[model samples]
Target chain A: MRVPEVLLDVRDLRICYETSRGCVKAVDGVSLEVYAGETFCLVGETGCGKSTLALAIPRLLPPNARILSGSILFKGVDLLRVSDSKLQELRGKEIAMIFQNPMTSLNPVHRVGFQVAEVPVTHFKMSWREALATAVRQLGRVGIADPDLRSRDYPHTFSGGMKQRSMIAMMTTCKPSLLIADEPTTALDVTIQAQILKLLHELKNEYGLTLLLITHNFGIVAEVCDRVGVMYAGKIVEVADVTEVFEAPLHPYTKGLIDCVVARRKSKSRLNQIPGTPPSLLNPPTGCRFHPRCAYVTHECVKEEPRLIEVRKNHLVACHNYEKVGGVSWSS
Target chain B: MELLVVEDLRKYFEFKKGLFARKQYVRAVDGVSFSVERGTTLGVVGESGSGKTTLGLTILRLIEPTSGRILFNGSDVTRLSKEELKHFRRSTGIVFQDPYSSLNPRMRVKEILERPLKIHSDEGEESRVERIIKTLEEVGLSAEHLMRYPHELSGGQQQRVAIARAIILKPLLVVLDEPTSSLDVSVQAQILNLLLDLQSRHELTYVFITHDLLTAKHVSDFIMVMYLGKVVEYSTVREVFSNPRHPYTASLLSSIPIPDPKLRGRKRVSVVGEPPSPLNPPKGCRYHPRCPYAIDTCELREPELLEHDKKHFVACHRAGELSFREFLADMDSFLSE
Candidate 1:
């Protein structure tokens, strides 16, 4: 089988947020790629800049955020170099993003149907009536019962799952090629979360869309993601096939992270914690950001930044002690 | 030897629609019966509206139970008056979720931990300060943290302070409501380890409540699964996880991704649709509408929580007949399709 073609590629992306103190280096020289029609996940802890890197793809950075230098190559077009009008057109037509919490992302006062309808109306210049009709149909596709009636309901009237469904409907209305869902099921229950995951999978297949899923939940990454990218302090630490990464995690942070989840364990033992906290991006540690917290800290690891080196086929890890960090078997 | 026995406990809230309209009763915790053995952990797992929080609060008498007896050491807590409860507070402790909101933002850590000791015990100022420092040390903090405010500490530190306060009194029972849910995964593991350590040291019984099944399985000796204000399945952690008895339990277990790529294509029960409203819940089995193996009997009659084995309990009409493997197959097909 031939290697799949790359859809979105980021090269030397750096993002900084202006605060009262100084510039917080959120995304520091991060680079990764998303293949067409594949679910690629970026897993990291909170404030690790995975979300910032995601938002930067569609130029959805906040007012205080500044993109110092990067080229977001989407279908061979540098999204950063694209015109403002072109980026706006690119947002809903080719790339769309879902947030961690749809409660804040969605307009509470507006009817859910109107929000979904606005996507097509603004993107395709459809009439209000035509868009509403299309929005209702899309809502039904997401498994929200009584699409016509539920579409008329406001965000406040819907459950966490329903609100996410409406958001999914709005995002995928135009069949955007890349769907960036950031913690889509974090606020939802396990049962409802399964349904949402199923809906996302179904929609991904139906639209033949490449999905960039950002989440901290390893369970979600295993279930839906085709490939995985481990992000730590704004850098892509490891990138590999989901199975390869889970079975034999290369980076110390990746191994420590996968070992943290309770479900992934083979035996009942104390969870292996990544000691210390995620470093403050305002003034991160030199060499490797994760070296301070990593269990296997070497002299060079603390002095020299390890490049993302591929030790195995299709598996990349950024760790001076990648070979030392042995594979932990998850199969019990 | 049970430390606490909750017999057919019920807690309901009345909401009046209009000035003269009939007040609707929302049955939050309906006839839940369970026991907490001394020095053991009982985890209550459920969705947001599944009454897990309400059950915890009611156990602490934070909310008045509609009807039931809460026996603590053979003393009825529900019957305890306001004056008598002052002494009772020494025996029970309650730690809420969301440490940011739970800890008083204005108060210092020393003040927060001191108030419980002063109220529950007769410790002087010097002894109180010493006790505070000792308790903080137990939760992996130090004396320096006492001077800082809640905002000064990280999310994990604030939670440690919260846990410190809960155990300072050395209460026989501490009702911890989703203590680890809000923390980062790494921090969450530390907190879980701390709780287990504190439990062993203090000889405490914990009512660990959370929505995450994995966390629940890790910390709990006995797990009580709640649904729509009712106990659907209550059993040992091994039974609930390895061989779930109730349809809801099996569905919930399968729905959770096993966090292994090898188990990616594996089948899991596909439970769709939202849980029914607690206000006007279904007449018979509240879960029948969403339960895949729902039969006429499930809809017609409410199944009692029956004992399958010595410790395993399930409330399902077709618990014996409906093979659990079939449920896993249903979920596998749900994914394959």
Candidate 2:
């Protein structure tokens, strides 16, 4: 068996925001590894810290946010300890990130092609003329029809799907190995979303990219992820192969989420919903953050946090009562 | 019996191309017609610029239609006078897509739900309070939430308050426009189940407008597919999912990403491009540019919606000649080594 090379390894990452009320633990002690040329997904609800953990890898947290502890090693180099100028050199050329909203990400005043060309020009010190040529080719490759004419057009003229395609074209200009897409298709329509997902899949294969896809939608996870990580509050509760995560989810939180999506396909039966809202991150629940909503909650879950432990081959679950949790088989 | 029937409804918003160019009409709801039965849901599924929300609002008379008849309970709602329209609105309700923006942050839950009652009813204050309490309980909220402001409630609880406000008058028809799109799956499931339970208990006719296919399939008895402000296909939910005739409908059904890795590994039939702009929609069929099976005739002439099978209507030039399921099956096998 060929041993997969580790591309990005994050260990014990604890990110927090110093607000007026208190310090909000956005991502608390998250440790995961992204293998080379594999798509790893972080699936969770809103404010679950999946985005925080992803942003921290690029060292792109907001001003108020701080990484209290942990190390982010990309290709055996510590990204957290790197100099600001060194990080900037590596940002667009080696590690790139795309945001959820395409409208705000690109400057509305500039032509779309110029913005895309700026990536290579700034990162690699390429000539503007050559980079612009590359920009047009990349635009065409991203499925933009009439690239020559559309490339000259402003961002406002591009549709939502077109803008996202342009964003992808711009991001891939440097041919970055690790692409962190945070809710890439959340703003698109269903058909357009399908088109973008297909484009991302094609690009992943063509570039041999290591993708860290963050989304709340399970369907996207099932569609693209090779492995899945189920995050709650600020910690990952379960990590497994894509099929195992769906077929035999060990954690109760993971089971509840899968059941929510699958039960809808079986006609008008009452949907099984997880009771209670996600706890506030200001003072996240003492022990397991999901224990308040977990069905198999016990006293151990309330008093102590369970570290991620391998319950089976390559299947890790962070729950004290994995033995008690029911298996969730895929119905369809 | 049909609780709500719309005939040849049209809404056109006029805007100038440039500063001095002649005014052109954006045919938002160019020509739409459908009916909701007494106690069943009619799901309106479409992408953006499809005018599903416009149709919903036009039915409620929030936006006056340019032409056509809106018959609610056997009366032309468009012809009603101002006072008569006020009375007509009491029989209908609407829930918007975002609960965060829909509910005023400053107002307490009690005041937000109480506004609808005050506008429609002339009952005493004591009775109005009693009705509000009862409606809150029905939507799974207790009296504790009544005094709390909208910001203090969670998204699911806020949506429940929105539902409670919509049904507080005991309206017969409710238009829910993407009510659960902004929620988590678990919370979304709770809201959907609550809607279904409320629907059966109150015998409410619903026009559920959403872009989520799974949620639509769960709650709707009938599904309506719209493109560029026109109904492309209309049929029972079973028929639409099982044997879709229109290329657009087939593309929609095929585009839905099912939550299974095995199916994901199999080939998916993705429609090629983005939807065209509403202002400059294609001449013949709006979906022809993106459809996989578009022929020369599809670009030249529009197809009228006609019954291809029993109780299933489709607007396509080649509705029955091509089998979409066979196409998908062939694609799946053809792509897999």
Candidate 3:
């Protein structure tokens, strides 16, 4: 019944990557808000700029990626306008990120304990011994059995699930108020995936930490996320409560994506597939980026881009014909 | 008549230590047994290191098995001579998960498809070229793609080319190892539908290996759930999904995040921890360490795979102790949330 406090506000974010094939508009004119203590999910298929937007928040873009225009406001301060020194102070302290590939993100040459310890060691300027001790404790919290001994092992020796736990432990070393986990469980097995999801859910509630999860798996979205944002062609096409999105998807892209998964499926016939592959961000379609594959495309939809408008209470969609295309009735 | 049958196949790799140190053996595919009749698919589903991929490779004899027999059309492949093996392999094809890596970048799509024909068939230049063109068309690719290298094609197109290469030989059995995992869902749907159509038309038996339970259920006539190199449960797609007998299979099924938001709050058994180290898989039942319903006897003795229902086999010590309905109900409860 009440609007939650916005912890991170991304307004008019536009990011482009300088590639030899020309500039790619990776994150184009995106605006979003993450409220405090809510596990928000940004779900999309590959190459939809979900990762790009996540990296933009911490100004962790690669060398070729440039923030064309945007402001990432975190707790009333523009993360983009902040000085490098200020960002350094904020990163891994007030906000932490857990990447999809922990093996690459972690320093392989070092022990898992030492790598996780690096977070606290550098941020708090704690002694190596003190940090290592804290790392063991954090690893234990994330359910790494025998954390005391396992912490001494190399990350390469750890399984995918263990490596993920170590990454989660490392990310939370500073006890950040917000955590951004990007496809953390995508590479894991279903059983191991369930464990990781449970751990993440437990950690989110225990620490009262706001989470920004990026994944393409609708199952993971329903399992852990509270609010969901559907992404297509570097644009947010729909945003709603997780229940609202799955129960009644307003955007055609959102409807098509949910229809493709087998779990929530109703028909035994061929899946309701979206007609074409995702549009190339290098030269995206005019007006609505999803119009090329949209089932309810129209003259108005092709001429002008639509903005997020609330058709139902707290449910926002960016499609011109939400009423016509939102006829996606789920058995649930 | 069975198209392919694997009898208790075991493939192990020995890691040599120092002269004084003992050798360590990794049983990548241990005591796995299954069979598929003509025009049917046997889906092998498992998590990483569960040997699902290794099992696929072993069936194709890409890797030598440590023991057991691979019977193809009632003939033992393990006993085949090198020359006989070469000829025998012509009827079997395998499509890997990463299409980009599997396809040769140096060769054009034409050469890739032609090489198979050159090795297996004695068809002359004209017919070979014609076959190559036809194969490309069969996979929904036009002749225009013949000259292009793998790098020139998109992921979906490259995968189509890989599929084309696999079926170009007109193999009796095609092993699809996580074929659609790397592609997007829309592309995945197309590839799956194509595979299904091809299977029915060509009467090809498939060994579909993947970690996705949903896809396994959809594309398979029968399903085999493997964990740590051993089969935990094997049954018809409907039975395995609806009435899973093994705790591991039940846990695996429940773990798949049902895509409905309303089901989010539903009860689901959350497997507590990861599988133990393969080298030290728990003493008795491999799944006992993580099984929520694990009992004391489970830790002392392993459960043999038994027929719990018609054609449904499960390996769980408590299979008789606990009804699958109750086990499934308990599995549906979320431990953390």
Candidate 4:
């Protein structure tokens, strides 16, 4: 088998936020690699730092957040060392991100057409007329009927699904190699979510895009992701092929997360819940952040943090008792 | 015996564009009717703008219904006197979708749970504290949380506090409106399990309203599918899952991304286009514009909700004639392939 080229390589990235109480370690020494032309999903509960990691890839961390130590290599270029102009040149042209709420992301005062046209105009330096023309066609390409009329309307006139489509259209105007979608479909309805996800998959195929999808919903991961990384308390616990992640989850948190999704199977049995809440990032636990909630925690788990290690080819797990989690008796 | 019954409940809000402009009606809850058994849950499933929330609120008289009636234990809630309505409100409770907003951030957990008791009961301060502690324990919270404010608690704990407040009065029925939608998946499971445990222990009837079909199926005995302020399909959970008569229901079922990765490419019905504006909904079948199997009659004539099979109600022009079984079977075959 041919080895896939690495598109985005993140190494030992640590991110923290300055707060009144203390420094909140949002992403603590996490490392992962995304391959070209493949969908990599970072799945976790809220506040697990998946979104922060995604934002960190394109150097989009807010002012309050600081990168304690890390290197983000995109196409063999370390973004952290890049100059402001160089990073700005690479931002929307090569790396684009879509947030959870398109309503908030899109400017309410500007027409949808003008907002989309601004992308090509700013990045490629196209003329206003040419950019406007391109925007209409781009809107049509993203399944917006009558792009001419719809493009003239403001964000308020568009529905939630349409607003999302416009966001996708604007993001893909440059056809970036890497698209970081942070819970892109979390706000839409089920049917509309299906539509948006299908649109994303098609766009990925059309553009040969490498997708970094950050989501809490496993269903979306099952639908689109080629590989999966399960995050817990700002640390990655497991990374594996999508199929293996479901069929044979090595980490206890991964197992608990999969079992927690109320599956389609109609049964009265109770869902398997991870005991205790996630540790506050201000001052994490003594050792493993998940030891308090893990069902298979041992003395070793509490004393030291487990490192992500390759237990099998292309599959990794960070758990003291991963061997005990092998037997697949998944209720769902 | 039916514990709660809503008969043709309707809630319409009027919007006037100008002083002389005609007052247009936004039928938020056009007409919805359902009943719940004493110990069972009726899951009200729909997307946004489908009026499921309005229906829940109207049933509790939190949002007064413009028309129709709500009967609790054979007593008409709409006709109740001011004193009787106050008495009736104590037996019914509602937990909103967003716990962070539903809870008063200024109030501590003890005061939050105590507010309902102080208003509804004449118990002494000592007895109320005892009751508060017991109720907190029931929702898996402890005395430590009592003194903490809402912001100090996590999302799941805030929801548990909301649930505790809803049940502290020991109401016979509780309307859980998307209680777990805002929570993380693991925390969602914890809250769902807690709710089920509470229901069985207290014999409480729940009107569980949510947009998630999987959660609705998991917690509900009967499922009611809504679209544009109307019930498109209603049946026992088993019947709704196995033989969905309404095209919208079938589309909704097929649209859910089954968590199993193996079922990725399974056949599904993509209801083309989004739901039309509720202010000016489609003339005939509300779902006709998006229904894949929409026929000419579906656009010309509105269909009444009729019973197609024992205990299965569907509002569609071609409910019985359309073979959703064949469509669903095709999906099942592809899923198992």
lDDT of 4 by residue, A1-332 (tens): 99999999999999999998989999998989999999999999889999899988888889999999989999999998899999999988899999999999999999999999999999999999999999999999998989999999999999999999999999999999999999999999999999999999999999999999999999889989999999998999999999999899999999888877777343556777888788899989977889988889899999999999999999999988899996445542
Question: Where does model 3 exceed 4 Å of error?
Answer: A124-130, A265-268, A329-332, B327-337
Best model per TM-score: 4
lDDT of 2 at A316: 92
Model 2: residues with Cα > 4 Å off, grouped in runs: A262-264, A329-332, B327-337
Q: Looking at candidate 4, what TM-score does chain B attain?
A: 0.97
Worst 10 residues of 2 chain A by lDDT: A262-271
Q: Choose the strongest candidate by DockQ.
A: 4
What interface RMSD does every candidate have? 5.3, 5.3, 4.9, 3.4
The sequence of per-residue lDDT tens digits that candidate 3 reaches over residues B81-163 is 98989877899999999999999889998899999899888999899989989888888888999999999988888999999
CA error at residue B291 for candidate 4, angstroms: 1.2
Put down candidate 4 lDDT per residue, B1-337, tens digits, no spaces.
Answer: 8999888989999999899999999898877788889999999999999999989888888878899989999999889999898888899889988999999989999999999888889999999999999999999999888899999999999999999999998899999999999998989999999999999999999999999988898899999999999999999988887788899998898888777788788777669999999999998999998988989998999889898999899999988787667656744522221
- What's the candidate order when arranged by decreasing lDDT? 4, 2, 1, 3
Model 4 docking tier (incorrect/acceptable/medium/high) = medium
Docking class of 3: medium
Residue A322's lDDT in candidate 4: 93
Docking quality (DockQ) for each candidate: 0.50, 0.55, 0.51, 0.59
Cα lDDT of model 2 by residue, B24-88, tens digit: 98899977888889999999999988999999999999998999999999999999999989889
